[model samples]
Target chain A: MVEHMGAQFLLSMTTGIFIGGAAGYLGSLMLSKRMALVAGPLGHLTLPGIALALLYGFNVSLGAFPFVILGIILIWLFEIRTKLPMEALTAIVFSSGVAVAFLFLPIEQAETALVGDISRVNLWEAFVSVIVTSIVFLVLKKMYSGMVLISISEDLAKSEGMDVRKYNLIYLVLIAIIVALGVKMVGGLLTAALVAIPAAAARNISTKLAHYSFGATIIGAMSSFIGILFAEISKFSAGPLIILTNTGIFLISLVFKNRGRR
Target chain B: MTNDFVLKVKNLTVRIDSQNIIENLSFQVKSGDVITILGPNGAGKTVLFRTLLGLLPHEGEIEWKSGIKLGYVPQRLPFIKDIPLSVNDFFKLKKSSERETKEILDSVGFRENLKKKKIGDLSSGQFQRILIAWALIRNPHVLLFDEPTTGIDISGEETVYSLLARLKQERNLTMLLITHDLSVVYKFSTDVICLNKHLVCYGPPRKVLTMESLRQLFGEEVKFYQHRHG
Candidate 1:
């Protein structure tokens, strides 16, 4: 039964499943850590990665890596050198990335930046995104306690002998890879939703944050699979169609959450 | 002839932004000494505790006699909006074994049924007991508590002190207790330090809480409490 989908869709599904799963897992951890909102700007911030790669003759993901590394370093340095929190650092670095991308990328690529084409996405791109995202998430899952502790109290996290700054820096670099891959698949505009919506929707209902993450993966995959179907049927752009499905789910979750309170 | 010092703070200075929280502070807590630091709010009692644990960044040396592990109980807050952690899970963070966790919780008079309850469901006093259990699990050489009895019941309060007193004697643990409660001040502590921004007095409780010093420290409030207690 599993083999019937053939290697193409099967591999694409593997790419989609794990990438969606990994994003959902890390996204939920970030949500519980209260860094869910940071994903938004960080996603947008990767635009320069694509643009710079085009200009400098490098892979978009590789180009994005340095910028994301810079962003993470800047946040840690700012916290150590100054005292700004991670959220504030994300905003600052994100804006800087957008500015640099705007300044450098040709105006012709602006439309490309706005609409990510998952349909045209090739095997190599999917393979790289899936592999990198999986490895990063695998590492992060092991350090779950350390990450959660940092979210609870930075001082306590440090006293526990886990460098909170280092953990955050690691999270940022992975986030950059995800954002870089997201630019081609979902486009920069909706990439943050790809990280945030699944997690947020799960959080509205689950008791444990871990459970919420699992739920997020299911939700993300379903959104992508169904959105892909709807886009194929309606002949709409896959990126926008996928995001709209996610948004619809988000709104429904919001209503259900409010009703649960009453 | 002496246990010397289990914990020592030498000329500790902490400046957050421009304001000084711990200003040129120096103190020593010997082995088995239960020291209570009395201070009003904003007097930096919490700051002092945080500094000792190497939590908050500070200047100057916090030299500890080797093998001096610390157990801390932070100020409690209402249940976090949503994050799942059972009491057992919380205690495990302190490196306590299941058997030790059960014994410590029982020592603090928590019901056996509550070992599985989520931290969010426990009441204030029950939660504080759980915190105490966490601290005890570390079997720390020094126990630093900031207002440990704030939300406890009267019996729980008595139990806490008796348990602390017992732990100090049995384990020879040194304790640094920061609290505003005067009733237990003389009863539980061997040394009392009157702190208001700086160390105003440090000696045996009777000498430190003299009427003259009371009037000097808190003005009229001390007189009122003294009269009420007397």
Candidate 2:
């Protein structure tokens, strides 16, 4: 299989797994907190960054980083100031990002920018993905219980002496990082699906948090690997294919959910 | 300063968006006392509770005896029904052992088999009991209940109150409870605090829950229900 696939395809597959697993794990937390819908807007918010990066001839992830961080900060601040739900704040930020993106990006680069073309991934991008993914996993592992407790009830977590605001900020930063890294491979439009779908599927079948997280990671990695392979064979874009694979998994998990209910 | 005092709040005020939700509230909680807070809707009952727990920002002195362990049961768990969280998993948030979880559940009258059942599937009474069990597992010195029996039936409410009373006696735990029902106040509270933004009155249920105070707190629309004294 290694001999058959080109080097770029192999690198893309590896990058996809790392990004997908991290996204899936983070997605589980977001889903548990009912902030899953926020992922889509955050993903879309990466567009201006990618556009700026394209215009400036810099790394797409680097360009997306500031905007993603800005988006997180704005969302957090607006949530505190306006007391609006995260979904609403995300909508406001995402629309602004889209409007800004259209100003800088050439129309020709829009397709690849909207839906990522992972064949352009280099060795540096692959290495960065691995490093960032490892950091995300470690932080998530340490914060998992505390985050879950906060999700259950902020007052309960506070009673236990956990700093809920600090953890929430950390969580948003993690999401910002993941969205920045993911937009190049999954595209801004479909990146949130990479985060959300696996977790959605995992929760349908999992009875415990550990199982849900592990199931999400497995499904995500598998989808990325298989989706990349299928795209290579079918001459289709890998980003949309990966999302389609995750959607399929989500649909299948609903069966397990319904069965368990009965 | 008494050795029996578990919590002390003096001139506590909580303001949000320049509006005071709780103003100049002062109260003391003694060990082994079930302090029931009574108020009408939007009377800042929940705000006061949150302030006492240090969940909300407030001014003035709010002190807990150093190193005192506290357990809390909110009026409702804010979980969506679609999530696949089981009762066992809910307990796992506290990192409780299986035996401990089982013991707590049994103590709260929840069957061990229900551990594997989804938390969303539990009835209102069962969920309330589970919340109680969640608190019990902590071995807290002070337990707080914010309308614990809100959605439960009348008989179920009685059962919950009885359970709370038995637990209070057995554990010698200090309790702070928020309730709308005067019957619960009459039956379970050792002290009652009538609140509408500020403290209306505070003392033993017999002295503080008189018609005038009730009228003052809830206004002319309030209806008083009499129950045989517990």
Candidate 3:
């Protein structure tokens, strides 16, 4: 099975596991904070950068970084200055990002930029994805308790002498980096599905935070692997297939959750 | 500046969107004093507490005697039921050990084996008690409560107040409480501060909680009932 598929397919699969697992883990924190709704907009915000990168023949992930970081900063500043809810701030910033992308990107490359073509992934992109994913996972592990405490109550976290603002900024930066890395393989439109669906599925079956996080990672990795395999065999787009796989897992978990209640 | 004063606020002002929520407020909190703040809705009680805790950006001096730890029990725990957190998991935020958690829960008179129970499953009184236990685990030099008994019943309110009074005596802890209930103001407080955006009066409950001040803080429609206790 390994030898039959070409190097590009294998590299894409490897990238998928690392990115998917990391997204799943971070997604659980986002869900707990009631910030999951921002994930979609943040993902879409990467399009302008990817479009500019393709136009200029630079690394798409590298190009996506500046825009995503800017978006995160804008959202953070607006949240603080206006005291607006994060979802609202994200919507405002993301709509502008979409408008910007349409301004620069040609019609021919728009579909590929929107849905992604993982089969075109090269060795270096795969390697960068693995490294970035590892860093994301490690940072999230160290900050897990602090993040959960903040989500529980910012006032409580503040009383404990924890810098809630610093942690919040770090969390947004991590999400931006992950979105940048994922946009190349999953496409800007579908990147949030990688972050959100597995976590939603995991929450259905999990009774503890630790279990929830671990379950999300497993579900994410499984979906990415299976989706990539099926897409290769059927000549279908890998991004939507992966999301569909995650949705299927969520439905199955919901059934189990309802049974447990009984 | 003296050791007897646990906290001193000098001309503290908090302005949000060009509106002054707390303006030119100054007070000194002595060690081992139970100071309760009485105010009507939107009187900036919560904002004052947040300013003192350094949670909000404010203009003025809020000086705590060096190294005095502060604990806070918010008006209510927000969205505890919406999250799937257990009591034990909630305690773990403090990084307390299992033994410490059990001891704190026992101190708050929660005798059930509720460590594994979801926080949302607990009754309002139980949840409020858990918040108290959480604050106690820190062994704070001063504890702050913002409308601690808001959702509790009348009987449960008595229990919570009595428990707080007992804890204060046992631990020799200074307390700052925000409340609208006059009974709580008279019964538990060593000092009362009547506030409506600024300090109306501050002194012993009998001196400061007069009908004239109540009318000024609340409206002319306000009625005062003095409780007689043996």
Candidate 4:
């Protein structure tokens, strides 16, 4: 444990835990929908926004927000117009975002954008993220069954009175918000892993979706807490450590599943 | 619209990718009609169903009776057997009441014990019944089933057939079923629509399913064993 629980450290930690948990829960839906790799490219789509944030010396999420939203909207539009698969559309935006980001990104500031510095979080940012996380959690919980119903059968979902395209656009926007907040905890390159791995672990042992969904949140929060704490103690890069911690939890979950099966 | 009409499609045309999948297709259905649609692969049966459901934009009129609940069993088999949802969780995606879930499950002959079983672990037969159950729980006035040839219980259709018949008998549901199976039409369909981009024929299956119609809808070598239907 750290000798001192400084206020700055606590604020960053709280925001990290909340974002990690929400991302993990969102990832459960992504995994079930068979779009697990979506978050990775969406992370890459955040680069242009993060670069602008770094250039302007503002909160990184504020800059990342608009760009991620633009990318998601474009992906949605192209998905309808071209009828291309979502992964292909996301890959298209990912490349464009990265290429655009590098046009004016300073070499010295590149590392911070690529590998985030959570300690840069301010009290106001932390508070905003907390509120956003709670609202996302509740709204997602309401939409959870409806969204999963769409994945099960779009026709069925439509018959149930869901507007599939509208729900999908809204779903993408929610994902954008989470991805924007995620950049500060694990940076653009590793944010997908942060979202995906915990959900994967939770699925291993869960029979019901409620278990899988809630379990992912807990595992996600645990990984962020342990990873960030250890990083602070060891002076290591938090992003890589957080991902490694997520992987460890996934492996343990595999073992737990095997044990339960036997 | 007729007083007891369940559905009416007038000059319906659906264009996708700048190509017309369905063109000037028209049909009407009564309250208790079981209309079976048959055609070879690439026929617009599925497209017609989607157009009627208002999922796809169409340049014609499709109408359902006001305040009628619709349940659709999609054509493509759901590859959900590997996902982490229990059967009960799958039902919970729509209905939340324990009593309703149990009632729906039992109506389809689904064992109560299997409620906790992962949907991914159920046999295709069980899953198919579950899909039927999922649709039936809504007490829909009509059911649309897109029946593909494979990925369901290929060894037998007895359970599913009986379950569907029983449910329809009890509820007096209007049905629109799309299938490639001729025996299904012989056994259960009140009316059959033969389609291949245009309406080939539409009437009682006995008169409408002549060999000439089959060859026209399918290809020159088309044949079927109508007597084997049971």
| Best TM-score among the predictions, by candidate number | 2
Candidate 4, B127-230: lDDT as tens digits: 77888888888698999988856777765466677677888999899999987778878788999998888889999999898888988987843744433342
Provide TM-scores for the models.
0.83, 0.94, 0.91, 0.92
**Candidate 4 runs further than 4 Å off:** A1-5, A83-92, A257-262, B1-3, B77-82, B224-230
Instruction: Write candidate 4's Cα lDDT for A4-83 as tens digits.
Output: 45877898789889988998888888887876677777788788889998998888888888877876667657866788
lDDT of 3 by residue, B33-113 (tens): 999998888889999998889888999899998989988998876755535677898898889889999998988888648
Candidate 2 lDDT over A1-262, as tens digits, reads: 5764588888999998888888898888888888787777877888998998888777888888887787777776776778887767767777887888999899888876788877668889899889999899899989987888888888888977888889998998998888888788788888788888999999999886678889988998899888888988999988889899999999999999899989
Q: Rank the candidates by TM-score, best first.
A: 2, 4, 3, 1
What digit string (tens of lDDT, one per residue) describes model 1 on residues A42-136? 66667787787667755555665665566555655786798877677767766776787899888876655655555544578678877787787
**DockQ, prediction 1:** 0.36
Q: After superposition, how far is residue B38 of candidate 4 from its true place, in Å?
A: 1.0
Where does candidate 1 clash, by residue pair? none
Which residue pairs in candidate 4 have backbone atoms (N, alpha carbon, C) closer than 3 angstroms, thus clashing?
B81-B120
For residue A187, what is the lDDT in candidate 4?
79
- For residue B1, give model 2's deviation from the true position in Å: 6.6
lDDT of 2 by residue, B1-230 (tens): 67889999999999987899988999998888899999888888888878878888889999999989888888886653545678898888888899999988888877899999888878888888888889877699998898853568777777888899988887888999998778889878889999899999999998887878888998854654433332
Best by DockQ: 4
| Chain A TM-score (model 4) | 0.92
- Kindly list the per-residue Cα lDDT of model 3 for residues A1-262, writing each as its tens digit: 5664687788989998888899888888888887776767777888899899889877777878887787777766776778887778767766877788899898798876787767777788889889999999999999988998898889889988999889998999898888887787678788878888888898888766678889988998899898889988998988888889999999999999899789
- Pairs with steric clashes in candidate 2: none
